[model samples]
Target: MMLELLSPLPASLNLGLVLLSALTSGLSAAAGIGGGTLLIMAMAQVMPATALIPVHGMVQLGSNGGRAAMTWRHLDRGLLAAFLPGVVLGALVAAWLLVRLPAGVLELCIAAFVLYSCWGPGWPQRLLGRGGTLLAGALTTFLSSLVGATGPLVAAFVKQHFAERLPRVATFAACMTLQHLTKAFVFGVAGFVFRDWFGLMLAMVAAGVVGTWLGLRLLHRLSDQRFDTLFKWMLTLLALRLIWLGVKRLGGA
Candidate 1:
């Protein structure tokens, strides 16, 4: 019974999930973005719809939680303090309201956000003071519930606020950790059975830690300009794919 509860997943798929977790964490660690989205997309290719969202949320919580611990010394406490209250409010609304956006609408919004992050005129740093921070938090967390992977959305905000690589990466991880934690709470309240996937989730998290360590080491060697270029290109391609997905969803409907 305990074994069954730990993981109903087949041995092969469990191995794949662990590997995917590590690779995606490595992506986040090196790029300071996109890993969570990639992980969810990769897993979505194989996971059942009923189990996918909660299970993906659990893995990301672990992945970002590990990164947050790794970079705690550099975390922006003021930013977090400003941002977190909105997260709480956002999560509460998601739990109570159950905002089920139309699939086409969500896909379009995500694509638009991704494009804006890459090419649009960004909001000024001065304008997004404490209030801006709170609104950013509220919107990102709210969208996270609907969109599956919002790392890039929050990353765009963090990048706008922090120009340096280390501080930017640290804060990004911390915010995502908080976001994933809140998501986990919403899932629990909604009665998703987390216990069933504990074994696989734990394995994936452990793998993520190793990947994060490797990626961080690589990050130090890469140039800031190079990383930024890579980040934008990757985001653009992902956004295009999202737009395509949205079109497909709209067509299907």
Candidate 2:
């Protein structure tokens, strides 16, 4: 029965991913970042190249949607409002250009930016404002459309504006939900057959919701100081991974 429900993928792998969904979702909920990036990295190891980005986006959509709904009250409305328009514009631009950036180069640039954001001075207040949010939404969405995991970049940018954990997590979830939604739509238009993978996606999402609930509980127990320190280090490690992947890719090229 379970095998039929998640066809094509081996039963063991399917079950493992469902569990990974829960685990990564919990990681994001408690830590304020890294879940989506980690999930994509894992999926890339097993999923088909053509289906990887779109499938990953759909799974993330479900995970972030659940997170956003759970903490809706804490979301920063003004920033979200400004950021959303950029998401739409970025999607349009990416679809129009149909450009595929060299994965290695893009990864390296993103890693650099993420490292700077994590350890360097905060962006000026003006840059974290409406105009900046709009630009960020567009750029991150564009990059996500190409690369599939911009969670670290988005999280690094979002962290600059909010100090508290709940608002940051909530707002970041909301932002990612839209970004992944747009990516799904773009890939759908480009003719990816989503239905074939729907069953697996649904199962993964269900697992993620359970994980999110547990993660939020953990989040509540964490001190602000601890959360900040953990969040930065988590991003730093993820960034380092990106740098490694980028270098490996470039070397191969």
Candidate 3:
């Protein structure tokens, strides 16, 4: 009932996972990409399918919350306003259908989209208008609810709109935090058994704090262009992996 198949591992293992999540989140945050994508993938290997979204959402909620707080001054209020309504609507829909949706299909679609976005010419730059940003938020939130982590898509959209490096990182972090919080609330409402995962969540949050601090420092030292290039390639690889996993799941199904 508690969703643990084997016994819970030692605290050390949990700590290591949390720290790894934190490091990944921090790097992803610093690079102006969302860390939730990596976090969810890593967690999915351990947590039950039913528990994945809520657990990942809570940890990411904390990770992004911290990053956003650290970069609050650079947030774009107008952009945030335009994005919120769509995100709220998307979150509602995603929560309702999460359990019923064919996850393999959903994940495959997401992976395809992400791959095209990365490889397709000028897609990110072309989708930088107010309308595009709002749509990006809605789509990203919807995909995130079902897939557990698709920060790269949102990051691509935000990166295009915000020319300044710091503003880009800050705004992306803020937007992702909002999306993750919405997801956590939706999962809670849908009865995702949060009470049993408190210890794991706490460990992740603590690691996130440390990782965020280090990432912020590293972000300041890196060149924006270099980070952007690296981020795009990283996203492409992640997308490929998702596609592969989706294919495997579909085969099994």
- Name the top lDDT candidate: 2
Q: Tell me the lDDT of model 1 at 93.
A: 80
RMSD of each: 3.6, 3.6, 3.9
Q: Which consecutive 10 residues in model 1 have the weakest lDDT in total?
A: 1-10
Candidate 3 residue 100 Cα shift, in angstroms, is 1.3
| Candidate 3, run of 10 with poorest lDDT | 1-10
Which residue segments of model 1 deviate by more than 4 Å?
1-10, 99-127, 223-253
Q: Of models 1 and 2, which has the larger lDDT?
A: 2
CA lDDT, every model vs. true structure: 0.78, 0.82, 0.73
Ranking by lDDT: 2, 1, 3
lDDT, residue 247, model 2: 88
Model 2 agreement with the true structure over 1-253: per-residue lDDT tens digits: 6755684678888888889999999989988887776687667557765577788889999999999999999999989999999999999987765445454665676567657656776445567878899998998898787667778778877888888889999999999999999977788777778988888899999999999999999997755667567766876787787788778888885
lDDT of 1 by residue, 154-195 (tens): 887889878788999999999988888897887777677888
Candidate 3 stretches greater than 4 Å from native: 1-13, 103-126, 223-253
Task: Report the Cα lDDT for candidate 2.
Answer: 0.82
Clash pairs, candidate 3, are none
